[model samples]
Target: MAIELKEYIVAFIDLLGFSAMVQHDCERPKKEHRYIKVLYTIHLKTKELKKTIIGLEITQFSDSVVLAIPYSQENYKKVVDVISNYQYDLLNDGILCRGGASYGKHFSTEDFLFSNGMIDAYKIESTIALTPRVIISKELIDLVYPASELSKNEHLILESDGLYFINYMKNGNADDSWKAICKAIPDELSENPSIRSKHIWLIDYYNHQFPESKRKDNHRFVSPDA
Candidate 1:
Protein backbone atom coordinates (compact mmCIF):
# COMPACT_ATOMS: atom_id res chain seq x y z
CA MET A 1 0.00 0.00 0.00
CA ALA A 2 1.26 3.42 -0.94
CA ILE A 3 1.61 5.86 1.97
CA GLU A 4 0.89 9.56 1.80
CA LEU A 5 3.95 11.22 3.20
CA LYS A 6 3.86 14.90 4.09
CA GLU A 7 5.58 17.46 6.24
CA TYR A 8 4.30 17.64 9.82
CA ILE A 9 4.77 19.59 13.02
CA VAL A 10 5.25 16.99 15.72
CA ALA A 11 5.45 17.36 19.48
CA PHE A 12 6.78 14.40 21.45
CA ILE A 13 6.04 14.61 25.19
CA ASP A 14 6.95 12.37 28.12
CA LEU A 15 5.41 12.50 31.56
CA LEU A 16 8.01 13.22 34.24
CA GLY A 17 8.17 10.77 37.15
CA PHE A 18 5.78 8.40 35.41
CA SER A 19 7.38 5.32 36.93
CA ALA A 20 6.73 6.72 40.38
CA MET A 21 3.10 7.16 39.45
CA VAL A 22 2.92 3.54 38.28
CA GLN A 23 4.57 2.40 41.49
CA HIS A 24 2.17 4.37 43.65
CA ASP A 25 -0.80 2.83 41.84
CA CYS A 26 0.04 -0.60 43.23
CA GLU A 27 1.40 0.41 46.61
CA ARG A 28 -1.25 2.91 47.60
CA PRO A 29 -4.88 2.37 48.60
CA LYS A 30 -7.68 2.50 46.03
CA LYS A 31 -9.03 5.83 47.23
CA GLU A 32 -5.53 7.20 47.04
CA HIS A 33 -4.81 6.19 43.45
CA ARG A 34 -3.85 9.69 42.40
CA TYR A 35 -1.98 8.89 39.22
CA ILE A 36 -4.87 6.88 37.80
CA LYS A 37 -7.22 9.84 38.14
CA VAL A 38 -4.70 12.25 36.67
CA LEU A 39 -4.04 9.93 33.71
CA TYR A 40 -7.75 9.53 33.09
CA THR A 41 -8.28 13.30 33.12
CA ILE A 42 -5.41 13.78 30.67
CA HIS A 43 -6.91 11.09 28.43
CA LEU A 44 -10.26 12.88 28.27
CA LYS A 45 -8.68 16.29 27.66
CA THR A 46 -6.49 14.95 24.86
CA LYS A 47 -9.51 13.29 23.29
CA GLU A 48 -11.50 16.53 23.34
CA LEU A 49 -8.59 18.57 21.99
CA LYS A 50 -8.19 16.16 19.06
CA LYS A 51 -11.86 16.62 18.25
CA THR A 52 -11.65 20.39 18.57
CA ILE A 53 -8.51 20.77 16.45
CA ILE A 54 -8.89 19.37 12.96
CA GLY A 55 -5.92 17.44 11.48
CA LEU A 56 -4.29 16.84 14.85
CA GLU A 57 -3.05 13.25 15.09
CA ILE A 58 -1.99 11.67 18.34
CA THR A 59 -0.34 8.46 19.53
CA GLN A 60 0.31 7.60 23.14
CA PHE A 61 2.11 4.71 24.80
CA SER A 62 3.04 4.34 28.42
CA ASP A 63 4.59 7.63 29.57
CA SER A 64 4.98 9.31 26.18
CA VAL A 65 2.54 11.14 23.87
CA VAL A 66 3.06 12.28 20.29
CA LEU A 67 0.99 15.07 18.73
CA ALA A 68 1.30 15.88 15.06
CA ILE A 69 -0.40 18.07 12.52
CA PRO A 70 0.11 18.86 8.84
CA TYR A 71 2.84 21.46 8.45
CA SER A 72 1.37 24.94 7.89
CA GLN A 73 1.38 28.20 9.80
CA GLU A 74 -2.20 27.63 10.94
CA ASN A 75 -1.59 24.02 11.91
CA TYR A 76 1.64 24.94 13.65
CA LYS A 77 -0.21 27.45 15.83
CA LYS A 78 -2.89 24.88 16.56
CA VAL A 79 -0.38 22.26 17.69
CA VAL A 80 1.48 24.81 19.79
CA ASP A 81 -1.78 25.89 21.38
CA VAL A 82 -2.52 22.29 22.30
CA ILE A 83 0.87 21.80 23.95
CA SER A 84 0.69 25.09 25.82
CA ASN A 85 -2.74 24.31 27.22
CA TYR A 86 -1.80 20.68 27.95
CA GLN A 87 1.38 21.71 29.77
CA TYR A 88 -0.42 24.37 31.81
CA ASP A 89 -3.14 21.92 32.84
CA LEU A 90 -0.61 19.23 33.71
CA LEU A 91 1.32 21.61 35.91
CA ASN A 92 -1.94 22.47 37.64
CA ASP A 93 -2.40 18.79 38.32
CA GLY A 94 1.12 18.57 39.77
CA ILE A 95 2.28 16.64 36.74
CA LEU A 96 5.31 17.96 34.88
CA CYS A 97 6.40 16.82 31.41
CA ARG A 98 9.21 17.32 28.92
CA GLY A 99 8.84 17.45 25.15
CA GLY A 100 10.33 18.62 21.88
CA ALA A 101 8.42 20.00 18.88
CA SER A 102 9.84 19.96 15.37
CA TYR A 103 8.84 19.60 11.76
CA GLY A 104 9.71 16.87 9.18
CA LYS A 105 8.21 14.30 6.82
CA HIS A 106 5.86 11.85 8.50
CA PHE A 107 3.15 9.21 8.11
CA SER A 108 1.09 7.54 10.79
CA THR A 109 -1.88 5.22 11.35
CA GLU A 110 -3.62 3.64 14.32
CA ASP A 111 -1.17 0.76 14.67
CA PHE A 112 1.93 2.19 13.04
CA LEU A 113 3.81 5.44 12.80
CA PHE A 114 6.92 6.06 10.68
CA SER A 115 8.39 9.52 10.54
CA ASN A 116 11.66 11.31 10.64
CA GLY A 117 9.73 14.11 12.40
CA MET A 118 8.89 11.76 15.22
CA ILE A 119 12.56 10.90 15.59
CA ASP A 120 13.47 14.58 15.66
CA ALA A 121 10.73 15.42 18.15
CA TYR A 122 11.67 12.55 20.45
CA LYS A 123 15.35 13.41 20.30
CA ILE A 124 14.52 16.95 21.34
CA GLU A 125 12.43 15.75 24.24
CA SER A 126 15.03 13.26 25.42
CA THR A 127 18.22 15.20 24.82
CA ILE A 128 17.39 18.87 24.31
CA ALA A 129 14.49 19.27 26.69
CA LEU A 130 16.57 18.75 29.80
CA THR A 131 13.77 19.84 32.13
CA PRO A 132 9.99 20.06 32.51
CA ARG A 133 9.26 22.12 29.42
CA VAL A 134 8.36 21.70 25.75
CA ILE A 135 11.28 22.90 23.68
CA ILE A 136 10.47 24.03 20.13
CA SER A 137 13.08 23.44 17.46
CA LYS A 138 14.99 26.17 15.65
CA GLU A 139 13.71 24.61 12.42
CA LEU A 140 10.15 25.01 13.58
CA ILE A 141 10.87 28.60 14.62
CA ASP A 142 12.15 29.47 11.16
CA LEU A 143 8.90 28.26 9.63
CA VAL A 144 6.86 30.68 11.72
CA TYR A 145 7.15 34.02 9.99
CA PRO A 146 7.23 37.57 11.49
CA ALA A 147 10.25 36.50 13.49
CA SER A 148 9.77 37.28 17.18
CA GLU A 149 6.16 38.37 16.76
CA LEU A 150 4.67 39.82 19.92
CA SER A 151 1.62 37.53 19.86
CA LYS A 152 3.95 34.57 19.79
CA ASN A 153 6.03 36.10 22.55
CA GLU A 154 3.35 35.25 25.11
CA HIS A 155 3.89 31.54 24.54
CA LEU A 156 7.59 31.23 23.78
CA ILE A 157 10.50 31.96 26.08
CA LEU A 158 14.08 31.88 24.81
CA GLU A 159 16.52 30.09 27.07
CA SER A 160 20.17 30.93 27.70
CA ASP A 161 21.00 27.69 25.88
CA GLY A 162 19.43 29.27 22.75
CA LEU A 163 16.36 27.01 22.65
CA TYR A 164 12.75 28.22 22.82
CA PHE A 165 10.11 26.54 24.99
CA ILE A 166 6.45 27.08 25.67
CA ASN A 167 5.90 29.44 28.58
CA TYR A 168 3.02 27.59 30.22
CA MET A 169 2.31 30.27 32.81
CA LYS A 170 2.73 33.41 30.76
CA ASN A 171 -0.99 34.15 30.92
CA GLY A 172 -0.55 34.92 34.66
CA ASN A 173 -2.71 32.26 36.31
CA ALA A 174 0.30 30.75 38.07
CA ASP A 175 -1.22 30.88 41.56
CA ASP A 176 -2.86 27.46 41.29
CA SER A 177 0.14 26.08 39.45
CA TRP A 178 2.36 27.64 42.08
CA LYS A 179 0.38 25.87 44.77
CA ALA A 180 0.64 22.60 42.89
CA ILE A 181 4.39 22.99 42.60
CA CYS A 182 4.62 23.67 46.31
CA LYS A 183 2.99 20.33 46.96
CA ALA A 184 4.88 18.33 44.34
CA ILE A 185 8.38 19.75 44.78
CA PRO A 186 8.89 18.65 48.37
CA ASP A 187 8.68 14.97 47.54
CA GLU A 188 11.06 15.14 44.59
CA LEU A 189 13.41 17.39 46.57
CA SER A 190 13.73 14.69 49.22
CA GLU A 191 14.71 12.03 46.70
CA ASN A 192 17.54 11.99 44.15
CA PRO A 193 19.60 15.18 44.26
CA SER A 194 19.57 15.22 40.47
CA ILE A 195 15.80 15.16 40.41
CA ARG A 196 15.80 17.87 43.04
CA SER A 197 17.96 20.01 40.78
CA LYS A 198 15.50 19.55 37.93
CA HIS A 199 12.67 20.76 40.15
CA ILE A 200 14.82 23.71 41.14
CA TRP A 201 15.39 24.50 37.47
CA LEU A 202 11.62 24.71 37.04
CA ILE A 203 11.33 26.91 40.08
CA ASP A 204 13.99 29.20 38.69
CA TYR A 205 12.16 29.35 35.37
CA TYR A 206 8.91 30.06 37.14
CA ASN A 207 10.39 32.79 39.25
CA HIS A 208 12.16 34.36 36.31
CA GLN A 209 8.99 34.46 34.25
CA PHE A 210 6.64 35.61 37.01
CA PRO A 211 8.86 37.79 39.13
CA GLU A 212 6.02 39.93 40.44
CA SER A 213 4.44 37.10 42.36
CA LYS A 214 5.01 37.09 46.12
CA ARG A 215 5.24 33.30 46.29
CA LYS A 216 8.52 33.49 44.36
CA ASP A 217 10.63 33.91 47.44
CA ASN A 218 9.09 30.94 49.23
CA HIS A 219 9.69 28.76 46.19
CA ARG A 220 13.42 29.34 46.23
CA PHE A 221 15.77 26.57 47.34
CA VAL A 222 19.00 27.52 49.03
CA SER A 223 22.15 26.05 47.55
CA PRO A 224 23.85 23.32 49.64
CA ASP A 225 26.91 25.50 50.05
CA ALA A 226 24.75 28.35 51.31
Candidate 2:
Protein backbone atom coordinates (compact mmCIF):
# COMPACT_ATOMS: atom_id res chain seq x y z
CA MET A 1 0.00 0.00 0.00
CA ALA A 2 1.22 3.45 -0.91
CA ILE A 3 0.27 6.48 1.17
CA GLU A 4 0.36 9.84 -0.52
CA LEU A 5 1.41 13.04 1.20
CA LYS A 6 -1.25 15.68 1.76
CA GLU A 7 -2.25 18.66 3.88
CA TYR A 8 -4.10 18.08 7.15
CA ILE A 9 -5.71 19.68 10.20
CA VAL A 10 -4.00 18.40 13.33
CA ALA A 11 -5.73 17.90 16.67
CA PHE A 12 -4.06 16.99 19.93
CA ILE A 13 -6.49 15.70 22.57
CA ASP A 14 -5.00 15.34 26.05
CA LEU A 15 -7.12 13.68 28.68
CA LEU A 16 -6.95 15.64 31.93
CA GLY A 17 -6.60 12.76 34.43
CA PHE A 18 -4.87 10.37 32.09
CA SER A 19 -1.65 10.89 34.03
CA ALA A 20 -3.55 10.15 37.21
CA MET A 21 -4.93 7.01 35.64
CA VAL A 22 -1.40 5.90 34.78
CA GLN A 23 -0.09 6.89 38.19
CA HIS A 24 -2.93 5.12 39.94
CA ASP A 25 -2.13 1.99 37.98
CA CYS A 26 1.57 2.40 38.72
CA GLU A 27 0.86 2.54 42.44
CA ARG A 28 -1.39 -0.50 42.15
CA PRO A 29 -0.28 -2.71 39.25
CA LYS A 30 -2.94 -5.32 39.96
CA LYS A 31 -5.62 -3.10 38.44
CA GLU A 32 -3.78 -2.67 35.18
CA HIS A 33 -6.32 -4.71 33.25
CA ARG A 34 -9.04 -2.12 33.87
CA TYR A 35 -6.89 0.64 32.41
CA ILE A 36 -6.09 -1.57 29.46
CA LYS A 37 -9.78 -1.97 28.85
CA VAL A 38 -10.13 1.83 28.62
CA LEU A 39 -7.23 2.06 26.18
CA TYR A 40 -8.68 -0.68 24.02
CA THR A 41 -11.99 1.12 23.87
CA ILE A 42 -10.22 4.26 22.77
CA HIS A 43 -8.39 2.37 20.08
CA LEU A 44 -11.58 0.91 18.69
CA LYS A 45 -13.24 4.31 18.64
CA THR A 46 -10.27 5.83 16.85
CA LYS A 47 -10.40 3.17 14.19
CA GLU A 48 -14.10 3.66 13.73
CA LEU A 49 -13.63 7.41 13.45
CA LYS A 50 -11.00 6.93 10.79
CA LYS A 51 -13.29 4.69 8.80
CA THR A 52 -16.10 7.20 9.05
CA ILE A 53 -14.03 10.23 8.17
CA ILE A 54 -11.89 9.72 5.11
CA GLY A 55 -8.36 11.12 5.32
CA LEU A 56 -8.40 10.97 9.10
CA GLU A 57 -5.60 9.30 11.03
CA ILE A 58 -5.27 8.83 14.78
CA THR A 59 -2.73 7.48 17.22
CA GLN A 60 -2.78 7.16 20.99
CA PHE A 61 0.15 7.56 23.39
CA SER A 62 -0.71 6.28 26.85
CA ASP A 63 -3.29 8.87 28.03
CA SER A 64 -3.69 11.13 25.02
CA VAL A 65 -4.77 10.83 21.39
CA VAL A 66 -3.65 12.69 18.28
CA LEU A 67 -5.99 13.02 15.30
CA ALA A 68 -5.14 14.41 11.88
CA ILE A 69 -7.56 15.28 9.12
CA PRO A 70 -7.35 16.59 5.57
CA TYR A 71 -7.93 20.34 5.63
CA SER A 72 -11.56 20.64 4.51
CA GLN A 73 -14.83 21.67 6.05
CA GLU A 74 -16.49 18.40 5.20
CA ASN A 75 -13.81 16.33 6.85
CA TYR A 76 -13.67 18.55 9.94
CA LYS A 77 -17.44 18.26 10.26
CA LYS A 78 -17.16 14.52 10.22
CA VAL A 79 -14.43 14.72 12.83
CA VAL A 80 -16.73 16.74 15.03
CA ASP A 81 -19.45 14.15 14.55
CA VAL A 82 -17.06 11.45 15.61
CA ILE A 83 -16.15 13.40 18.72
CA SER A 84 -19.80 13.96 19.55
CA ASN A 85 -20.58 10.30 19.07
CA TYR A 86 -17.64 9.35 21.21
CA GLN A 87 -18.93 11.68 23.89
CA TYR A 88 -22.33 10.01 23.69
CA ASP A 89 -20.82 6.59 24.17
CA LEU A 90 -18.68 7.89 27.06
CA LEU A 91 -21.70 9.34 28.79
CA ASN A 92 -23.76 6.21 28.38
CA ASP A 93 -20.84 4.11 29.62
CA GLY A 94 -19.99 6.57 32.42
CA ILE A 95 -16.79 8.20 31.11
CA LEU A 96 -15.74 11.79 30.48
CA CYS A 97 -13.07 13.24 28.17
CA ARG A 98 -11.40 16.65 28.27
CA GLY A 99 -10.62 17.26 24.61
CA GLY A 100 -9.18 20.10 22.47
CA ALA A 101 -8.64 20.53 18.71
CA SER A 102 -6.87 22.99 16.41
CA TYR A 103 -7.27 23.16 12.63
CA GLY A 104 -4.39 24.31 10.44
CA LYS A 105 -2.18 23.11 7.64
CA HIS A 106 -0.33 19.98 8.70
CA PHE A 107 2.03 17.72 6.78
CA SER A 108 3.09 14.07 6.64
CA THR A 109 6.78 14.95 6.73
CA GLU A 110 9.32 15.31 9.54
CA ASP A 111 9.55 19.10 9.61
CA PHE A 112 6.51 21.23 10.49
CA LEU A 113 5.83 24.64 11.94
CA PHE A 114 4.38 24.34 15.46
CA SER A 115 2.11 27.16 16.56
CA ASN A 116 0.09 28.31 19.59
CA GLY A 117 -3.01 26.52 18.29
CA MET A 118 -1.84 23.24 19.72
CA ILE A 119 -0.54 24.93 22.87
CA ASP A 120 -3.75 26.91 23.26
CA ALA A 121 -5.88 23.80 22.94
CA TYR A 122 -3.87 22.08 25.64
CA LYS A 123 -3.94 25.18 27.78
CA ILE A 124 -7.70 25.50 27.45
CA GLU A 125 -8.10 21.84 28.28
CA SER A 126 -5.92 22.34 31.35
CA THR A 127 -7.70 25.48 32.45
CA ILE A 128 -11.04 23.68 32.55
CA ALA A 129 -9.88 21.40 35.31
CA LEU A 130 -12.74 19.75 37.18
CA THR A 131 -14.80 19.97 34.02
CA PRO A 132 -15.41 17.79 30.97
CA ARG A 133 -15.36 19.79 27.75
CA VAL A 134 -13.76 20.19 24.32
CA ILE A 135 -11.85 23.40 23.53
CA ILE A 136 -11.40 24.33 19.84
CA SER A 137 -9.71 27.07 17.85
CA LYS A 138 -11.54 30.09 16.45
CA GLU A 139 -10.44 29.11 12.97
CA LEU A 140 -12.56 25.98 13.31
CA ILE A 141 -15.73 27.77 14.36
CA ASP A 142 -15.75 29.75 11.13
CA LEU A 143 -15.69 26.52 9.13
CA VAL A 144 -18.53 24.66 10.81
CA TYR A 145 -21.75 24.96 8.80
CA PRO A 146 -24.36 22.66 10.24
CA ALA A 147 -27.51 21.88 8.26
CA SER A 148 -29.74 22.77 11.16
CA GLU A 149 -28.65 25.24 13.77
CA LEU A 150 -28.52 23.75 17.25
CA SER A 151 -29.89 25.42 20.35
CA LYS A 152 -27.50 26.93 22.89
CA ASN A 153 -28.05 25.56 26.36
CA GLU A 154 -27.61 27.77 29.41
CA HIS A 155 -24.46 25.85 30.34
CA LEU A 156 -22.56 26.95 27.21
CA ILE A 157 -20.38 30.09 26.94
CA LEU A 158 -18.38 31.28 23.93
CA GLU A 159 -15.13 33.19 24.54
CA SER A 160 -13.15 34.62 21.64
CA ASP A 161 -9.38 34.97 21.29
CA GLY A 162 -9.57 38.69 22.00
CA LEU A 163 -11.43 37.47 25.08
CA TYR A 164 -14.72 38.91 23.87
CA PHE A 165 -17.57 36.76 25.16
CA ILE A 166 -20.46 35.68 22.98
CA ASN A 167 -23.48 33.59 23.84
CA TYR A 168 -23.69 30.96 21.16
CA MET A 169 -25.61 27.76 20.31
CA LYS A 170 -24.74 24.50 21.98
CA ASN A 171 -24.22 21.53 19.66
CA GLY A 172 -25.69 19.09 22.16
CA ASN A 173 -28.41 19.71 24.74
CA ALA A 174 -28.44 16.75 27.08
CA ASP A 175 -29.25 17.84 30.64
CA ASP A 176 -30.56 21.00 32.24
CA SER A 177 -28.45 20.55 35.35
CA TRP A 178 -25.40 20.16 33.18
CA LYS A 179 -26.32 23.34 31.34
CA ALA A 180 -26.78 25.31 34.56
CA ILE A 181 -23.53 24.09 36.09
CA CYS A 182 -21.56 24.89 32.92
CA LYS A 183 -23.06 28.28 32.08
CA ALA A 184 -22.38 30.06 35.38
CA ILE A 185 -19.49 32.12 33.98
CA PRO A 186 -20.03 35.77 33.16
CA ASP A 187 -19.58 37.04 29.60
CA GLU A 188 -16.54 39.28 28.96
CA LEU A 189 -13.32 40.07 30.84
CA SER A 190 -12.60 43.61 31.91
CA GLU A 191 -9.22 42.81 33.43
CA ASN A 192 -7.26 41.71 30.32
CA PRO A 193 -7.40 44.22 27.48
CA SER A 194 -4.48 42.94 25.42
CA ILE A 195 -6.20 40.06 23.63
CA ARG A 196 -6.59 39.56 19.85
CA SER A 197 -8.39 37.39 17.29
CA LYS A 198 -11.98 36.14 17.02
CA HIS A 199 -11.49 32.54 18.16
CA ILE A 200 -13.72 31.08 20.86
CA TRP A 201 -14.46 27.68 22.44
CA LEU A 202 -17.25 25.60 23.95
CA ILE A 203 -16.94 24.22 27.51
CA ASP A 204 -19.15 21.84 29.52
CA TYR A 205 -19.04 19.00 32.04
CA TYR A 206 -19.41 15.38 30.94
CA ASN A 207 -20.53 14.14 34.39
CA HIS A 208 -19.81 10.57 33.36
CA GLN A 209 -16.06 9.85 33.54
CA PHE A 210 -14.82 12.44 36.02
CA PRO A 211 -15.75 14.98 38.67
CA GLU A 212 -15.21 18.69 37.97
CA SER A 213 -11.75 18.87 39.65
CA LYS A 214 -9.87 16.91 36.96
CA ARG A 215 -9.65 19.49 34.11
CA LYS A 216 -7.28 22.15 35.53
CA ASP A 217 -3.79 22.01 33.96
CA ASN A 218 -2.13 25.22 35.36
CA HIS A 219 -2.69 27.13 32.08
CA ARG A 220 -3.65 30.78 31.86
CA PHE A 221 -7.03 31.54 30.25
CA VAL A 222 -9.94 33.60 31.50
CA SER A 223 -12.65 31.12 32.53
CA PRO A 224 -16.26 31.64 33.50
CA ASP A 225 -16.85 32.98 37.04
CA ALA A 226 -17.56 30.12 39.41
The candidate that wins on TM-score is 1
lDDT of 2: 0.49
How many residue pairs clash in model 1?
Answer: 0
Error of 2 at 166 (Å): 15
Q: Write the per-residue lDDT of candidate 1 for residues 1-226, one digit (tens) a residue.
A: 7799899999999989899989999898898887888887887776677885888998888889999889998888777878888887787777889999999999998899989999999999998897898999888897785774934577788888988999877644658657867755774355576577678877888788767764544345578888
TM-score per prediction, in order, is: 0.89, 0.55
Q: After superposition, how far is residue 90 of candidate 1 from its true place, in Å?
A: 0.7
For each candidate, what is the lDDT?
Answer: 0.82, 0.49
Strongest candidate by lDDT: 1
